[model samples]
Target: MIVRTIRADDYPGLNRLHASVGWPQRSPDGWRWLADNPARREIGAPEGWVLVDAADRPCAMLGNLIQRFVLDGRSLYGATGFSIIVPPQHKGASRPLIQAFLDQPGVFAHYTLNANARSASLYGRLGLRPWPEQTHALKLSWTIDPLACLHGRLLRRAYGRVSAEAAETMGERLMNRRLWRPGPLRLPHGVVDIRDVSDSSPYGRFWGTLSEQGALIADRGAEMMRWRLADPDLPRRPLLLGRVEDGRLTGTALAMTAKTSIIDPPSLEIIDLQGLPGFDAIPLLARTLIRNARGLGAAKVRLQALTPDLLSRLGDLARSARREGGWGHGHAAFSDEAVAASWSPTPLDGDYLMCNRPVPPAAERQWARRRAQASRASKA
Candidate 1:
């Protein structure tokens, strides 16, 4: 077998490979974001690399997602692996594929999120290790809608005794007994307002301000924010909320809509939460997130890999994944020890933010039409 860079043509075969192992694959357009991304182009990183058999069919593959960050006033480049696969028949191809990814230059660090047991061991052998902080291994969750969060997990056991509908009714009544409305608190001053991505003017100089205080932070400037949200294949269109006070954004967050998996109901996953230091904007930001999530019919609001300061600001609803156990784990390898020590990894740092949701059928056709028009204009 020969190794080669991934191309647009390999999407179908890649999908086939995904199916062979019960993993979800994306449509051709869905796969385009990896290669067509402005960050990848600027950094000169390949979309991915694949090992092809003698017949020129891909047997194994490893995709690289590039990201840019700022650390202590210096810029840093990083790559995260995605959709890495090596079929059981081609066991030997695994290390080679991973090595190929590791060989990529101009990267200050490499990481992967939510690695399974098998993959974790493989990645460990190749020099990647989980984050040093115990917090990065914890999946801190906050229930936005108690009734919904209880349905499949806590309330399911009572189903054989009482009907699901009856159980739900009882749950609602139990919740109603307490006046737990955070509306008045989150808006103690009513200064916070909800705005669409078009009205993201407050974020104009947000990144510069943030990098001054934070040693390691993912780049989320105005243009980068627009690009990140513009990915056509993203599961749900993430809600970008900002805490606007005194005519500028005091705090902001990206609430990603998670359609959900087998046991849990749908939820609003907070990818990253940022706030200016002076006053605590997190509560206000959290309140806004919960309100919007409730309006959108989400069961819970979950945030993973929280920094210590951020975790402390999250008042109440602070529970681990299963009330005790954890489902979050971070794998990383950084060249600079000081940078690694200073790093407070958030969910935004890896491809998990983009691929967490189950892959749905591609429907964002406008991106294609727009690209075609641009192409035509360029040729003309």
Candidate 2:
């Protein structure tokens, strides 16, 4: 077996590997963006790594998205692992594939979301200690109908198009009627306005203020905002809402709606929320997001609290919201134990939202064709 950095020519092989493992093939445009984007390359090179057998055919691959972060008044680097693919025949090859990336220089740390129990165990043996902070996904609404929710759950189990459609319709009607109206947003004196804006809109001053405060945070400047929000493959175009006081930007939040299955109602998720230190703006932002999501037909609103201060404020408003924890581990190169412990990562830090996008019609057709071909190939 051989492991090497991915090259431009390896795009086809990578896609083939992904398909062979029953994953969707990325659009050509999306692949090129990942491979050639200057913003991504500015942090590191060669995308990620691929493992091949003696014949030079890829058996497994691991892709990384390196991101710049600020910690302890200094710049730090981190990477989020995504699209990890390994066929059943080469299941044992997974550990070595990840080990190769961890061995690379400047990698500091790596994180992933929703890893299986098996993978979690493997990561533990590699000396990555789980961060102690709890990553919560809170639901903002409490008006779901028991009957409709039960009906949708059963329909999902039946797994038919007609049943699925019925479930969604029922959910929509139930949620739309039960919507709870929050009080108007009350900003402190001198706070002028809050409204939605495009990702490319200027807010450098707002971000600079947050960065200067020295909390461990990923860079959320214009470059990252444009790259992440404008990606062609994003499931939904995130709402970039900001708070302005006296004509200067003070805070911003990115929210989007998602529904994974017929049984699940659409959820509004706050992927990133930031404001100046000591600024009591997140609560008002949360209220506005809940109202907007309700109007947009989402059944619930969710967000992760990245700091103790934000968590405390949100806890008061979303008292009935469900909470859960997330797991992560890292190495010293990324940051010292203290810095790593202080780091707070939201769902946006991983590829969670990216993977939730709706499949394009063309891609769906292509997937059906590929499945048919595979079925025939197996029988032959």
RMSD of 2: 8.7
The prediction achieving the highest TM-score against the true structure is: 1
State candidate 1's TM-score.
0.76
Pairs of residues clashing in candidate 2: 108-334, 235-357
Q: What tens-digit string does per-residue lDDT give for candidate 1 at 30-58?
A: 78865776678887888888999898888
Superposition error at 286 for model 1 (Å): 2.4
The list of candidate 2 runs beyond 4 A from truth reads 16-24, 37-39, 53-55, 71-73, 113-118, 135-202, 261-264, 304-309, 324-335, 359-380
lDDT of 2: 0.60
Candidate 1 C-alpha error for residue 31, in Å = 2.2
Please report, in order, the local distance difference test score of every candidate based on alpha carbons.
0.67, 0.60
Model 1 lDDT at residue 95 = 86
Worst 10-residue stretch by lDDT in candidate 2?
Answer: 172-181
In candidate 2 the C-alpha lDDT for residue 201 amounts to 46
Q: Against the true structure, whose lDDT is highest?
A: 1
